[model samples]
Target: MTREAMAAFMFRMDGTSSYQAPKVSPFADVKPGDKFYREISWMHSQGLSTGTRQTSGKPLFQPKAALSREAMAAFMFRLEKPKAYQAPKVSVFSDMKPSDKFYREVSWMYASKLTTGYKAPNGSRSFGPKQSLTREAMAAFMYRLETTLRLK
Candidate 1:
């Protein structure tokens, strides 16, 4: 699924059935003309997505960009807003360390069973946090999330 579709799905799951765009948009890339404008705007307004390149003058949502594993973790973490989530001292992925920016979220993903990292022949697991998330993986993630949360 596209990033916009994922954002819209998350919003709908969060009970945001419909909404109008804010007078001032938080994203420079998502404008009135965009098809997922409302959904993207709602996500940004709710602080779920901060965009990848916001610091640059031309901030972009990159709705068509492939969603990365780490990005998905961050998005779900924000959506869940779990109370008092604490990361373990060590990370489960051999490639990802505790100091990594996405470590906490990825750790939560593993602990919550939202993901099981790719295992190599050497018996080491890699989260592949920067890799693109596949459609099947996205569906599994959403399914697991709904099952875990028991969201109607």
Candidate 2:
């Protein structure tokens, strides 16, 4: 799914049956008339997203971009808004480094037992941060996220 679609799905998953569009969209790419404008606006208001980039000093949401696994992790982590959460100093996966943009979120996912990553033939695990999130993976993540939230 696109980032915009993910944002909208996550918003609904947050139990929002309905929402009103903000007077202004914080994203340069999302206009008031855009299909997911209200959901994206709500995400911005809730601190769930700050957009993917900035152009001319205005934030661009990159609504049409495909959702990556790491980005999904970040979104889920933000949705939980865990308090006093600290990412591990050591990397949990062979591919994910501490310096990566979504390291904290990916680490949090492992720490929270939301994901175990994929094991390789070399006996190493990879988070596949840049990979497009498959529908099955997304379902698993959502199920795990719901379970995690219920336990909290």
Candidate 3:
């Protein structure tokens, strides 16, 4: 799903059925009256997102872009807000290095067993950070996250 759809889903899951759009949108692309505007705004207000980029001094949400696996990892990590959490010193996935953006979040997901990643032919695991997250993958991630939350 697109980032905006995910944000809207997350907003509803957080028990926010309604929200008022911010007077000045945090995202340059998400203006008032736009689809998913209130939900995206709520996501930003709740500190779940800060948008994808900045253009002309305004944050850009890239609402229509497909959500990537690494991006999902970041979102889930931010939503959980684990206190005093630290990323592993070494890389867990063959495709991702410790120096990569979102590496900490993806590593946290692996450490938490929220994801096992795909097993490559070489027997090493790959996180596929740039891959678009499939619906099934998204559901699995959310289910694991919810289950983890319940246990905690």
lDDT of 1 by residue, 68-142 (tens): 888889999888887898999978899899998879999998888888899999998899988888878888888
The runs of at least 3 residues in candidate 3 whose Cα sits more than 4 Å from the true structure, single-residue gaps closed, are none
Q: Predictions ranked by lDDT, top down?
A: 2, 3, 1
Best by lDDT: 2
Indicate the worst ten consecutive residues by lDDT in candidate 2. 15-24
RMSD of 3: 1.6
TM-scores of the candidates are: 0.86, 0.91, 0.91
Error of 3 at 134 (Å): 1.4
Q: At residue 122, give the lDDT of candidate 1.
A: 96
Clashing pairs in 3: none
Q: Which digits, one per residue and each the tens of the lDDT, describe model 2 over residues 40-111?
A: 888988898998575477688899898999999999999888899898888979998899999999998998
Better of 1 and 3 by TM-score: 3
Error of 1 at 2 (Å): 3.5
Off by over 4 Å in 1: 53-58
Candidate 1, residue 61: how far the Cα is off, in Å: 1.8
Ranking by TM-score: 2, 3, 1
CA shift at 37, candidate 2, in angstroms? 1.3
